[model samples]
Target: MSSRGTDVEDAVDSEVAAPARGTGTRRRVGYVAGLFGLLLLLLLGAVVVLVAQGSIAIPIGEVLRVLTGQDAQSQLSRTIVLDARLPKVVAGLLAGAALAVGGAQMQTLFRNPLADPFVLGVSSGAILGASIVILGTSGVGWLSGLGLVSQLGVTGAAVAGAAGVLLIALGIARRVGDPVVVLVVGVMLGYLAGAVVDMLVYYTDPDRLQALATFTRGSVRNVTWNELQVIAVSCAVVLVLSVFLAQPLNALLLGDRYAGSLGVNVRRVHFLSLASVAVLSGITTAYCGAIAFVGLAAPHLARGLLRTADHRVVLPASALIGAVIVLVAEYVAGGNGLTKTSLPLNSVTAFVGAPVILWVLLSGRARRQAG
Candidate 1:
């Protein structure tokens, strides 16, 4: 009742509330860290299992030995683990991470939950670029057979194609100033690119078409160490750059005007993000073929699990989730050695992605109705 007594009581309550808030913050951080650790373990497990369980069935011990620089029991085991399965597994990791990060960036940049490289024509652009090179070149065999110079040329073409589509889409998006319109434009661009690729395939030699066919049906098996070098360097660089862009991306989520008010160079952020996505999507498509859905699904899954759209968390979480999805899909597709014929990576990814797409649509609809 007295002023002094009341003041003392208020100070005591403030101290108690501060400690409670700190504890809650610590608990949340721990929960997130635990989830990340579990994801990492799953990734490591998937890698080992995939590398070990191919047609030859290398033992897990030998797989670890080869991975850890120890000698395998047999030279054949070493070759199978290293020269065969390891590349594919590594490619899966890199491609998944790249696509997922690209997808997360696309979703933020466009402010559309469904935006992704595959959906938005970036992957198709890369495919068209590579198809032109593959269809135009004389006596070209499979991608792996191409010399390093030729391979680089094709990869370069893919990057250019991705960039071309991205620039066009961004320009149209700027002019229209509508996310829905941008989405439609992107889909149309994808269709146009696909039509051109189809025409090229129709006119090309049947034998040459085999190389192009692999581009549509995603598979990492063909990625050689040589090709891996390109995928590794480009994806690594772009992925690292994405880390730096996370804050700017989060700012963009609040809207360009607000982001600009906050001193974010909206145009520069857009350029860098678009460029990074182009590079990531293009390089992954070049090596692994037009893998689908990992990008689209991974970001959604990451956000759902992490329960946050903060790019700092979503970006890395999406990478790990995407890698795990690819590895699991690869195993199911034929890496398990259960079937003589392997399913396309896209086929497997569809099983995972389709449900997520539906869930997103339904959840969004529910939110709108409730609002």
Candidate 2:
């Protein structure tokens, strides 16, 4: 009788363990699925808000109608919705996602919480590249007439500039044990790029200066449908590449040695990551100007909210959050109802980003040296 009772208890224990494990697995799966759903909903909401609350306030119903297979409100509304507002929203969505993804990868690459896409001088390089094109072009009077070659050339130069900075920063980071030192090195690289941009601007024609100023401050209002085509194609290519890199990036978060043990080629991952980030940052800066903070803040916010340092989640999550932040900023600054003039994208973003950056610094997260 004692032996039989023991056997029955053993069977119960086994049954309980199986369900326990199963329940845990289901919970985790549900949590991740829920987060993904929330992100999708947020992005959808951002699109709705951006379209509905523009300079000419289109009704939510109208926005929904146009989004569906419905007819045009007017030729003007149709053009505005399809041509102007939609492209701007799309550009914001893409640009935000690109910057945030790049920035999130950068944080993981550096193994530091505060690392952002612009920290490694990508934005400055892009600005320098775009400035050169603007100063040299004849067809675009003061940044007015950039054709495809010039745009591609600018994006290429920006990518080159970004790659150059990444190589240098990576070298410095590898040699330096302290995260603070690495961040300082990044800052210096940015300053150097900014100095170069300044020198180019100084020698540039006064007529060209206006365009340079606009690009540096950042704005999505000026992007036409044709220019957006370039952005869409390039961003789509880079984004797909990002999805493929996500798993490898996860291995990396466990440390280079561990990743190597797990059969990940760290060097190849680094090279590909640098290229991907360069393309993402460069193309966005070329089209929309150097919009700051989204790259810097989006990843940080996503990680904080998700409570995981894992890049696999951080990367896509950052993209979705970035789209939300940028579109909201656009609505605020798009000169819809409050005023006739729009606010600079940089200005609105910095207002939020600067404080978060300061918080990081004050909390010693940015200042901490990796031991």
Candidate 3:
């Protein structure tokens, strides 16, 4: 690694380890447990409110009945809750958790606070892959007009695209051995991928663009239960895998050499972590259309609230916070009955993300490490 990289790792290691050493174990445990409990309750409340406040306006009681497998007062209410809002709400939940966990892993693996699938170009690659499939098939019709088989093809293409960018980024990072340079490279790759996508869009028939449009702005409303199965299975497996990597990731904070000395296979950890991030991000983007900022912002918020950088704590906390962020953003972006016209999920997410980016820049953490 470069001197700058080493310096940053040392700084991060100290900052991450100090709090754990200084605090009382019981007090920290209690705080973590309480925070987790509050987050779960908050998540539940968000789900209830989101389900209750859509266009049809189901009552909270009725929403609960539908959720708990009880009968609703009306068939319409049950249908709306079951067939319409429930899938969307669940999609938001899963997408948020997936992105946040992916973000947390990216930050650790790259040792860059700003690192994420969206910023690092992984999402763009997925977009490009999906676009190719969508536009290539536009000779027939838009994605919505296509059958389930074609949709699966698009999802597979997206995962391939994400994996492509990930491999390229990792290769360059290994050669450069500099976090800042890798970050810049990732950004450039994203732009390159985006430019290619734009060129494709420019040549394609405008009618097919309707389906492609949602791929850029992000949305969970259109995800069907079938797509949810793929997302749930992929995210669940990767999330559980992440739990196993927590200790190795913690060891890694101390630097690769030290981690190796402790018998952590740095190479194996990197492979697994990168693979997990690629899968989490690629799948989410394939279904949700490249949602942004949740992956970048949620981890920081988790670390701040928990006052630790341990992946075990940060990972789950980030997932919960991220889910809440998306759900709330969804509500703001026309999930509420008040808005007749809904905005894109990205538009709402940017409001939350831009401020966080500004704070990270103004805090001089990145700059200080680079210097």
Q: State the C-alpha lDDT per candidate.
A: 0.91, 0.81, 0.89
For model 3, what is the alpha-carbon lDDT of residue 220? 90
* Candidates arranged by lDDT, highest first: 1, 3, 2
lDDT of 3 by residue, 10-66 (tens): 999999888877776878899999999999999999999998997788889998998
Judged by whole-model lDDT over C-alpha atoms, candidate 2 comes out at 0.81
Among these predicted structures, which one has the highest lDDT? 1
Poorest 10 consecutive residues by lDDT, candidate 2? 138-147
Model 1 ranges off by over 4 Å: 1-6
Clashes of 2: 1
Give every collision pair in model 2.
Answer: 140-145
Q: What lDDT score goes with residue 97 in model 3?
A: 93
Top-TM-score candidate index: 1
Clash statistics: count for each candidate: 0, 1, 0
Clashing residue pairs in candidate 3 are none
Segments in model 3 whose C-alpha atoms lie over 4 Å from true places: 1-23, 138-142, 365-371
Tens digit of lDDT per residue, candidate 1, span 220-271?
Answer: 9878888899899999999999999999999999999999999999999998
Which pairs clash in the backbone of model 1? none
RMSD of 3: 8.2
